[model samples]
Target: MTSFPDPVVLRRGSADPQAPLVVLLHGRGADEASIIGLVDHLPTGPSYVAVRAPIAEGGGYAWFANRGIGRPVAASLAETMAWFETWLDGEYAGRRSVVLVGFSGGAAFAGGLLLAHPGRYAGAAVLHGTLPFDAGVPVTPGRLAGVPVFVAQGDADTVIPRELLDATWAYLTTDAGSLTTTWRDAGGHGVSSGALAALGKWVGER
Candidate 1:
């Protein structure tokens, strides 16, 4: 088993033990604190936790090593996913719903986790990120059948490769068989106000 440093976790929202859990994943070269603001923008009733990725890179941290931006290395992703699941299972030791919201590189990690363990998460939000394609895990058609997924992408996002983003959009909306909701605008690589509002609404309903 690969050993990793302790996860740095930032928490917000309801502290109720029975509340649902939302995991926030940050972009590459960013820390957990970078995405903590999302908790305030999201709905109530769910406790939100932002977990720092285990791998250090670019003065921040990353979920896994990648072949290129938005493309993860298969072995690296598998290792980090295993480490995250171990920590999550130990900490969130209940049947409470757990949702994943990831942005950029973190978005790919979020997609990897859901595709690897479809039944484990309540839902997933892919924000400005791509699905980890060939870096392991199954992206086979209908892998997320009946699952709820919220996706938002910038029409002009250049940070992540265009091909990967298109592929992610295509897979999630069609072949993945997820009950997907998508938002696209002329914005660039960052989150937009519209996307945040829609996410809050979606989280509230789900």
Candidate 2:
């Protein structure tokens, strides 16, 4: 297991011990507080726990930073994964399921972890993010089979292109044989009400 430093968690709603579990991850340069704000827009209750990445930046944190699709995954990936594993073990000890949620850089890290350890999560929602790329890392279907995934993207996203998203759709559904995906087509680089609504609906239908 990779070793991750302590993560900052932003608790909200109820502190009830038995609420459904959802782990929210912020994008690069954002803190857990900022990420937790999205919980206001999501279906909230006592069961949510928002976690900030351990990799601290000037004003926020980052799971991992890379130049683009071909760049090397930062050294922090392993440590972050370890940290997440410890958190999951402790937080979901008795829970049957968990929704792993992330945006931007956080989303990419979540995608990597879920893809590599599919059974660890009940489902994953990635907003404006993509699969990770590293020298030895390979995208395999068995890694995420049977998992339900929600991929929300804006058609106008300048950072992650539409073709890349299309390829991701193909890779998860075809190349990796594991997981079903629901995609949203909003037009921008950020999440929108429509996408959130769709995400909420998907969470329910799943």
User: How many backbone clashes can be found in candidate 2?
Assistant: 4
- Which residue pairs clash within candidate 2? 141-176, 141-177, 145-178, 146-179
RMSD of 2: 2.7
Task: Tell me the tens digit of each residue's lDDT in model 2 across 1-206.
Answer: 45456676877765666666778888877888877767777765536778888776768877764566423265656567767877778866877667788887777777777866787677888888776755235575466767788878777777765566667666766766655655666477788888888777766554
Whole-model lDDT for model 1 versus the true structure?
0.93
- Candidate 1 local lDDT, 89-149, one digit each (tens): 8988994799999999889999999999999999999999999999889999999999999
Q: Which runs in model 1 stand beyond 4 Å of their true positions? A: none
Using lDDT, give the best candidate's number: 1
Which residue ranges in model 2 land beyond 4 Å of their true spot? 1-4, 65-75, 135-138, 161-163
Q: Which clashing pairs does model 1 show? A: none
